[model samples]
Target: MPFIDLKTQYKALQPKIQRRINQVLEHGQYIMGPEVKELEEKLAAYTGAKYCITVASGTEALLISLMALGIKTGDEIITTPFTFVATAEVIVLLGAIPVFVDVEPDTGNIDAKLIEAAITPRTKAIMPVSLYGQPADMDEINAIAARHGNIPVIEDAAQSFGAEYKGKKSCNLSTIGCTSFFPSKPLGCYGDGGAIFTNDDAIALACKEIRVHGQSQRYVHTRIGVGGRMDTLQCAIVLAKLDRFDHEVEQRLLIGQRYNKILGEAGVTTIVQRSDRTSIFGQYTVRVQDRTNLQKYLNECGVPTAVHYPVPLDEQPAYRDLCKAGHTPASKKIAGEVMSLPMSPDLTIDDQDKICAALLAGIKQ
Candidate 1:
């Protein structure tokens, strides 16, 4: 079985995809085309955010958001260490210190209760990642940020574009939200693309300016920026994918629930999704003992498996000295045991059953 099953999804949407691509080709305005604005508008409305700024990639989305907030040298941005390095990388790129915090053992999300203690006078932002397509305790995290001089909370929703937190969309739940379109994400484009979302008008304007070489007008340099605009072709592709994104979200939920039930019945340890939130299950992950042997067994049985992260950011060679230390025992522990199975909206039930059975049987050995 394919790890992500993007081929199946593409096959289903071939016609619409071709049409969208054709439109982009005919327009020939590849940089900032009409499709870019159309997709941005649609996505902003979908997330219920007042503004959306499409960027070159998810990493750029985070980097540009920080630039908009004026993060600088010596600024401390508190975040969990248990996510993809991009979360902390963007913070450190600006000469800012990434204050690593522990995550919840069950959900593998940052522990909001532990955030306030990590804050200091230099703390500029609180960036919490929505890991494995499920949103973290955004409401609690936002409340914590509000108490501490109203620090800007950035939700790294790279894995959770279609997710929800207490009726609010993932990208619309915090002071600013960023999501990726790296083909494997819940809602992705053919290539690299991403977006920044915020309700704050000034922040939105700053992001807009910062994404295009800080141009307030044509050839008018207002601030330092990067080459971060999302290609019009990518935007067109995402717009086409948006047509069936709702159905895809529903299917992912059903598949994820089924995986939970089957694995739970067999005594497997899976991550928890809080009742108040909904996940898109970007990667259906589970914790297992002796993960190496189990992964070998599953692969032998035609099942593919991958680890979301084998090492926490703080433990990484590049980030160890750059990030501030904290008591993050949970991040280290979870990194060793967690493994992601094949997950896509198009994943078949038969495939899921076989994968789970193989995992269960592998555990016995």
Candidate 2:
């Protein structure tokens, strides 16, 4: 079976996808086309954010948000070490310091309880990732940021586009939120695409300007920026996918819950999603003591498995010197154990059953 069944999803949305692509083709305004603006508007309204700036990719979305906030050399941005490297990469790319905080053992998300201690006079922002489609404690994080002279908080919602924390959407849960459309995300397009959502008008305006080579007007460079606009074709594809995104999110939640129940009864340890938040099950990860052996066993049994992350960023060679010395026991422990099973909206119950059975058999050996 496929790890992420994009084929199945594409088959289902084929007609709408074709129509949208055709519209974009006919218009022939590939860059900054009408579809781009339309997608930005729809996504902003969907997330209840005042603005959504479409960017080239999720990484670009984070970079652009930091640029908008004027992150610079020596600026400290506190974030979790237990996520995709892109989470910390953006911070370091701008000559900023990535203060690696540990994550919660259960959810594998940034530990908001540990953030305040890491904050200093040089700290510019707090960037917490919504790992495995589950949002971290944004309310608590925001409260801490508020206490610290209202520092900006950025939610790296790369794996949590359609997720919810309380009644609010993931991408609108903090000062600024960024999400990806890397063809495997909860609501992805065919190619690289992403958006930054915010209620702050000034930040929103800055992001919009930064997305297009910092052009305040045609050929008018107002600020240093990257070529980070998501093209009209990609936007069109995402707009088509939006037709059934809500229903897809529900399906993903149901599938994730079923996986949790089945795996738990079979004595497997899975990541825990909190009651106040809904995870889109971006990877449907599980924790295992002997991950390497279990992965090999599963492979032998024809069950594909992958690790979300094997090394914490703080331990990475390049980041080690850049980060402050601290004992992040939880991040280190979780990094060695987390493994992801195949997950997609179209993943069948039968396939899941086989996978769980394989996992159980693998664990026994």
Candidate 3:
């Protein structure tokens, strides 16, 4: 089975997608077009955020948020090590330090209890990644940030656009939240697209300007910025997808829970989803001993598998010397054991059962 069934999704939404694309093409306002505003407004309403600034990519969204916050050289940003490198890459790109924290073994999300201890006077922000589409312990992280001089918290919600925490959407749970619309993501467009969400008016304004090279008005450069605008075509595609997004999210939840239940009955160690929050299951991963062999076996059984992350960012060559990382035993251990299975809203129960049977058989071998 295809890992992420985007083909099936596209087929289902073909008419709407074609119609949206046709409208954009006919208008020829490709850059900063009306569709862009329409997407931002709809996304903001969906997330319950005051503003949503669409950017070229998720990395750009994080970078722009840091710029709006005025992250400077030598400023420290606390984050978990067990996530996509983009989380720390953005920090290091702006000459800021990413202080590494351990993650919870169950969720692979930052350990909120350890966040406060990582804080120092130089700590300007706390960035928590919503790994595998489950939001980090946001309320606890926010409380810690509030206690520590109201340090801004940015939720790296690249995999969690449709997820919810404490009844609040993933991208609106913190001071600033960023999410990706990469083709494989839960609420993805056809290509690279991302958005920043926040209730802070000043930060929102700054992000808007920054996405267009810091333009306050036509040709007026107000601050140093990057060309990070998401094109109108991408926005149009996302707008069309939005029509079926709620149903897709529900499908993802049901499929994820099914995986959890079937795997649990067989005594498999899969990622845990807390009761207080919902995971969109960008990757329904499981922990296994001899992961390499298990993956090989599953592949042989026609079950595709992938790893969300195999190496901790702290252990990477580029980041080892750049970021300040203390002992993260949990991150280190989970890095080797975690393996993601095929996950998508369109994944079928028959395919899921075959995958689980293959996995259970592989584990016994």
C-alpha TM-scores of all predictions: 0.99, 0.99, 0.99
lDDT of each: 0.95, 0.93, 0.95
Backbone N/Cα/C clashes per model: 0, 0, 0
lDDT of 2 by residue, 1-365 (tens): 88889898888999999999999899899999999989999999999999999999999999999999999999999998999999889998999999988889999999888998998999999999999999999999999999999999999999998999998999999999999999989999889999999999999989999988898998999988889999899999999999989889988999999999999998888999999989999889999988998988888888888898999999999899887666688999999999999999898999999998999888888
Residue 42, candidate 3: Cα error in Å is: 0.4
Candidate 3 residue lDDT tens string, 238-327: 999999999999999999999999999999999999999999998899999999898999999999999989999999999999999598
User: What is candidate 2's local distance difference test score?
Assistant: 0.93
TM-score, cand. 3: 0.99
Q: Which ten residues in a row have the lowest lDDT in candidate 1?
A: 352-361
Higher-ranked by lDDT: 1 or 2: 1
- Every model: Cα RMSD to truth: 0.6, 0.9, 0.6
- The regions of model 1 sitting more than 4 angstroms off are none
lDDT of 2 at 157: 97
Candidate 2: C-alpha RMSD after superposition: 0.9
